[model samples]
Target: MTDPAKAARRARHDAIRAQVADEETEAAEAEAAENAATLDVSLHLRISHTLDAELRRRAAAEHIPTSALVRKLLAQAVRQHDACGLTAADVEEIARRVTREELHRSA
Candidate 1:
């Protein structure tokens, strides 16, 4: 024979735990879908032997795939180019700004 009060308490505790587990699972799935939505897939160019080796080495050092490394770099480059409609002069200006920032930060 089981105590009715103890059985009621146990049932309530189990229900609360189950509800928490369900909420966590729902939140995790929603986050995964949100992340997936931001992912872009498109055709990529193949590089030559030297470039491929360099990319592979860099990617390995960073613990990312070569394609991911290339994608990150290309995305940054595209964003910079698009930001100011970058020309040759804009590239030089940006390089100067970056160098100045690096030197200033290091000092």
Candidate 2:
């Protein structure tokens, strides 16, 4: 047997929480819209289960979607690669050198 006054107060509290959540979502969307260029062209990738799980876990921890986390990582990677002027060829050569050095050390 709950008091009517208590029930009303609980309802009001729930409604206020919902409203605040909605406002936060709207604010995030607006900020993303302003920061994005060309409204974000879609780039799809087939990720492994391990990567997918990691992305979901990290995104959940950050309170953002998995897609958003991936986008952030991709943007950072692109910026760093561009600044360093690193190409696919450079990456391949570096990998080869590292592998050869490791094999030589093991021998």
Candidate 3:
């Protein structure tokens, strides 16, 4: 049998530990909410099992979600492509030419 005073003290300690854990959880949730508010896009995708597992592992290692990892990768790719010396005017001209070609084909 345990002493009543010792049991009460242990119970109090457990209560304090639980309260601290609850506070930390709340703080983490608030930070995640703030991050979600800053995001501009919300997309959903279905991937193969192998790819999904790999993405999940990578995201865990990077401390981000799979979506965030993919977004960062896409942004980097776009920046690299844009740095290849093609101006915005060139892109516009190409788009115009493609549109004309498509229109003529459909005629």
Candidate 4:
């Protein structure tokens, strides 16, 4: 028979492992969907080293792939541009707010 304390600890570990596995499976499915939807969507962008570093850092902090982060940012940019022809200042402000919100959610 399992010892009570060990049994409780094992239960917690098992629960966490199961949850992580479920999350991983969901993420994989979502990624597959994202890939299947992109057709001739190849984009090559050149940016300053600083920007690249920041993007990599932010993506890591959010626990998402850099390509996924870039896709999300591009989608937001397109929507904002179409909605109002957003100026540089408007885009910058919106980006800052969005970054904060994303980081807060991750936290």
Candidate 5:
């Protein structure tokens, strides 16, 4: 009940679609691999138990890993021009302000 030429054309179209999808998936995986390769740096640090608990609490509150929270804070610190001039109190103030800002922004 179907025309042979029409059936053949449909088959070809389906095959082409499948091939394109496969190629796209392959390209995406390759791009992810390349990105992961570039971001493969590790850092380790030792801090007081108090700081560790605080970091874990903040990370949990933000629904991110502790490492991610630390990275975000460090990134913000790195961007500050007066970071070298910061005292302990100044650092605490900055951390509080950043935490508030992050919460407000996410809200």
Candidate 6:
């Protein structure tokens, strides 16, 4: 015959373990949500003629497609921007500030 007290203790232990597991799952989900919120999203830019020309030259020099080169450069820029503790807005503003310098350099 099973001991009623032992059965009750086992039930309580199982319930406690289940609750702990549920809490951990909730915490993990919250963390995943936070990380997703911090991830950078992709963008499609309509490049000006000068920018397109530069991209074509650069890509040809590297023997890669223009689109691929743009994607690679943009990914690197985003990583560097984030590494410097800059938000997307900061990156955009900095890029805008440097656009003239870049265009002149390309010219």
Best by lDDT: 4
What is the per-residue lDDT of model 3 for residues 34-95, given as tens digits with 9 covering 90 to 100?
56777766777877999889888987676666666777777889999888897899999999
Candidate 5 Cα lDDT to native: 0.80
Worst 10 residues of 4 by lDDT: 23-32
Q: How would you encode candidate 5's per-residue C-alpha lDDT over 1-107 as one tens digit per residue?
A: 46998899999999999997876676566556655765756888789999999999997686555766787798788878555777899999999999999999999
**Candidate 2 lDDT over residue span 65-99, tens digit each:** 67777878987999988899778999999999999
| Residue 99 in candidate 4, Cα distance off native in Å | 42
Q: Write the per-residue lDDT of candidate 1 for residues 38-104, one digit (tens) a residue.
A: 6655776766999999998997676555666777788799998789666899899999999999999
> Each model's TM-score?
0.42, 0.52, 0.41, 0.59, 0.41, 0.39
Among these predictions, the greatest TM-score belongs to 4
Q: How big is the positional error of residue 35 in model 4, measured in Å on the Cα after superposition?
A: 1.4
How accurate locally is residue 107 in candidate 6, as Cα lDDT from 0 to 100? 100
List, residue by residue over 1-107, the lDDT tens digit for candidate 4: 56998999999999999997887786677667888898647889799999999999988676666788888898999998888876899999999999999999999
* Candidate 5 lDDT score at position 91: 94
Off by over 4 Å in 1: 1-40, 86-107
- Clash count per candidate: 0, 0, 0, 0, 0, 0
TM-score of 2: 0.52
Of candidates 4 and 3, the better by lDDT: 4
Model 1 lDDT at residue 57: 96
Of the candidates numbered 5 and 6, which has the greater TM-score value?
Answer: 5
Candidate rank order under TM-score: 4, 2, 1, 5, 3, 6
> Model 3 off-target regions past 4 Å?
1-39, 86-107
Tell me how many residue pairs clash in candidate 2.
0
Better candidate number, 1 or 2, judged by TM-score: 2
Q: Rate the local accuracy (lDDT) of all candidates.
A: 0.78, 0.83, 0.80, 0.85, 0.80, 0.77
